[model samples]
Target chain A: MTSASVDESTRLAMYRDMVRARDFEQRAYDLFLEGVVQGTTHLGLGQEAVAAGFAAAMRPTDMTFCTYRGHNHTLLRGAPMPALMGELAGRKTGICGGKGGSMHLTDVPNHAMGSYAIVGAHLPIAVGAAWAGVLRGTDQVSVCFFGDGATNIGAFHEAVNLAAVWKVPVVFVCENNLYMEYTPIGDVIAVEHPAADRASAYGLESIIVDGNDVEAVHDIAVETIERARRGEGPSLVEAKTYRHKGHSRADPGKYRPDDEVAAWLERDPLTISRRRLEADGVAGDTIDAIEAESMIEVDSATEATRNAPPPDPATLMTEVWADGGSEWRN
Target chain B: MAELTYRAAVARGIAQEMERDPNVVLIGEDVAAAGGVFKTTEGLFERFGPNRVRDTPISEEAIIGAIMGAAMNGLRPIGELMFSDFLATCWDIVANQIAKTRYMTGGQVALPLVIRTANGGGNRFGGQHAQSVENWAMAVPGLKVVAPSTPSDVIGLMAAAVRDPNPVVFFEHKKLFAAKQEVPEGEIVDRLGAATIRNPGSDVTIVALAAMVSVAEEAAVVLAASGVSAEVIDLRTLVPLDTKTLLESVSRTGRLVTVEENPRLCGWGAEITSIVVEEGFWHLDAPIVRVTTPHIPLPAAAELEDLAIPSSEQVVAAVQRME
Candidate 1:
């Protein structure tokens, strides 16, 4: 309602990004099962819309901070598929040079700061980046992607208060995926609306959107991000969605009712986007080609990452300090 | 050379850095307007203005977290935690984020930050407020910990800390803030990982850290009168320890005594003792004695507080035991 209807090409692009994120996460999940990936990975399987939608709204100059389940965001931020997967496999050519596994992904050139493993810890850091942008007098907005669990942490309140007071250009996007790890947010948080209900306390504009609807997310993201870029201060956008996969590997998710899971699974973001694309006069063959291309991309990335060389032991002590201070072996 | 108090020297050092680089910012609780509770950052608020010099809310975690983020974003932020003891409240930011950012990012980003804090137990601040907790930072790999005893050392070392490529924790002892010394004029930056011999002697090596350096110096003067020649070495930085200087002194003296305000268990002195034993074992003619606070939290009472910190007499006794 704030702007013109999203074009057909942009709609197709959103669908494609969603498909790409889905394929990458599915392949990464398989890799985890096969023991090819070293540690556990938090997958954003059912929550792809928020990643693609918000990423679509952001400019190349804008910086992004994300949570542990951040591969989708990283890919949309311009990192190559091979590099991200390679990092997951602990290869030398990984995004973090194999130093950081899945939880820590940084693509500075692409403006993806890093994915923090700790919940709510990176919010303040994101505010700092936004403050830097404000100090430098640039239109760059720092977008912080956190989960529902982060809202309960002290850092969430501190960062939001600080950002609101300073009126820094920052967008706090909470991908409220119904649960925090294994625990449902309802059991933990006191509020009925986690992101929207709590916005006014920090003096921020709150928006609640169907996270499963990629187009709606895109529209709302575009508005909120523009508001931030215009120096309107920080805003909280809660993308209501659900995760298909468990919190981590081996979590069969026995806590949720079977009917609830089934119902949410039926409303999968990818399926909705695909259906919307077809209804929007986009050819079925074009959507099929996009899905097939995403599969091919994921396949090649996995193959390259599996074949990539492991990190050299000789280089293990490097990068601890930029000044070459206190090498681990030295 | 102008004589400045240790507190003034630290303030001047930060002021000089701010003048040199516009990107250098000071952010902490009570840093602006109040000029810091310790007054170490006095006059910085007025000189740098509120933008460069900021007074943050009493959120230690956010202060450090923001500083780390600002550093990564090409701003050099020097945040004060008020007391080194509050590091307990914000250890995660330092341990998981600041200490590991560069290494975890594979040198993709350099965090040029400085955490200036007040340390030591001589003040009647008691338990929580009066802990010399440099050992907590020394345990981390990426962090560089420097504690200066004299005004000259603080001014020079503080300048080096701000300009260092990595994150540095500048530990200023609470007792030495008012202590005056002749500081050299102009910009002076003492290199990290370097040790200076306060006094040369052939009998015993007295290695002291932070405020203990002065105690060792005093003990050295006392030892000289008793015909016990004790050499004093001031360890300016704890992380990149000047082991070569320590080993050389221990080799010449054939005796070692370490004095620190921290407890005996797992203290900075323990790290030095282990290093000496591992690398300089052959040079040691006697057991390396450590003059450290007894393993206990400092009590509030005046007498108990005085009893908790290592004294010049304790350093003298440790050196005599080493002999």
Candidate 2:
């Protein structure tokens, strides 16, 4: 069951999710350029397959945590396009009511807790969530999605060790996208396969998968996630992939060689899925139709965000504490 | 009423809360099997078992992070930092995650977590282990900072902290662990943002916090010997400061003196100075005097430690200097 084959329709649905994420990123980038969206955005331009495949494998009740580059993950995890886009645009109707912006997107009803901006910080939180499930004796598993950079931090090690010691149900997904914001993983991390090596140190099973391959990611994620749900303890899955865009809103790709960039771009998740669909005797128009629908959805989301009202300044002081409490007496 | 030691009061408060709510739990290094280094969580491990009372690794960041996560998931976790100085090691988690989660989420979540840690000097635990850093939590907008001087107040404040729907940093003084006070038998809870006037007088108003409350009391006794009546107010909770009670007392007394064990500059005492000068300036008959430890790190030696910590003599001198 670890390498189980998924049905063709299900595969197509996952491919469509990748396209949705891609289209949303492109549209949001355009909106950002036009000043419709406020604040910097961390786009997962070339890392859509991991998000799409992981989302496809998880139960809605299973909780997930993400890094700042979380737009794709939140969307695939069932955040409404209007609310997600509204948040990026700082609208009152946003998922977090416009207070959290892009770096802190959350959809608790869908069970994706948040996108913590700090590196490696959410690992312990995810461990705690998984521990809660263990205490309840439930089948719920927590997935913590972080980049290659987070692997070196103290929290990553501390949380993973605790999870393994307790035998809690969690899957630490390390999306090894090669670069940790301009610095190569090789420069910072010494391990050949970080997640695999780190996992063994903590007595956890590790799996290495091609992150750009939607089918592969879905297969491996399903296997690990199911094991966790069955209380088989925590595991680490490293998905090797690359980000086609710059690190964030401002960076340009002067640091990377053009050949390396061209090589990775050719293996883009959307292109790979499209070629697979064509070879499977699926009509080309069917693939084109999926892409067209995704574009329309993203464009409409942008239009709605433009018309959405700005966050009200009058309620700025509200919600600092649950009971509207303050540091001083009124 | 029952007489309990300060540490015993803390344990009873937690045990009672855990008995009432199954969701309430304690997690920290040496808390479970070891019963905590200071024995603040003594016998809790045996009472609740491994599930409720957890012993975590020496990871302050993870300790705080787990507390925040557990609380968000509908459990109330009481995390122990061992020493208040260690708050710097996990400041990111404390300041960013636990303190700001509910606010950043736009009230979609409530933390309902308490971080209990030993603070203040008098033990020869050196600068790192014996300092009081309540100002770190007090400066953060979303945190509630509570410091209790006596066993009764410890029991009451612990009950209040665990029940409040916000993150509260409950600072326990290491010096007062063996100190005994009368505590009511069951469920004694104090209001978080209210001050208790330990002694009332018309000559001067003396506001003290945590360990300094006792210091202020001794100073008031000395002032009484000199025929100068002094009012002493214990500002139990620093964040949701009982500023109104403070202003009212200062208005009546027409003189103000604040005492705290933290450094004299920008400490809890400094905060009171600003509040009094801003609100009760016209009511004040003399300038507000703040009695605090000198602006320096605490020393390990006994003599230097005594000099660095605020004493009853300093509080009295500040009051007499006002006269």
Task: Write model 1 residue lDDT over A1-330, tens digit each, in one string.
Answer: 321378877778888898999999899989988877778788889999998888888999899999889999998888899999998888987988888889998889899998999888899899888887777776789899999988999888888888888787888999998888888998887888788889989877668999988888999888888988888898888989998988877697889889999999999999988877777678899999999999999999999988999998766878888864445222
Model 2 segments more than 4 A misplaced: A1-4, A324-327
Which clashing pairs does model 1 show? none
TM-score: model 2 vs. ground truth: 0.98
lDDT of each: 0.87, 0.88
Candidate 2, residues B43-91: lDDT per residue as tens digits? 9999999999998889888888888877877788899999999999888
Instruction: Tell me the spans in candidate 1 whose CA falls farther than 4 Å from its real position.
Output: A1-4, A324-330
If you assessed candidate 2 against the hidden native complex, which CAPRI class would it receive?
Answer: medium
Q: Look at candidate 2 and give me any clashing residue pairs.
A: none
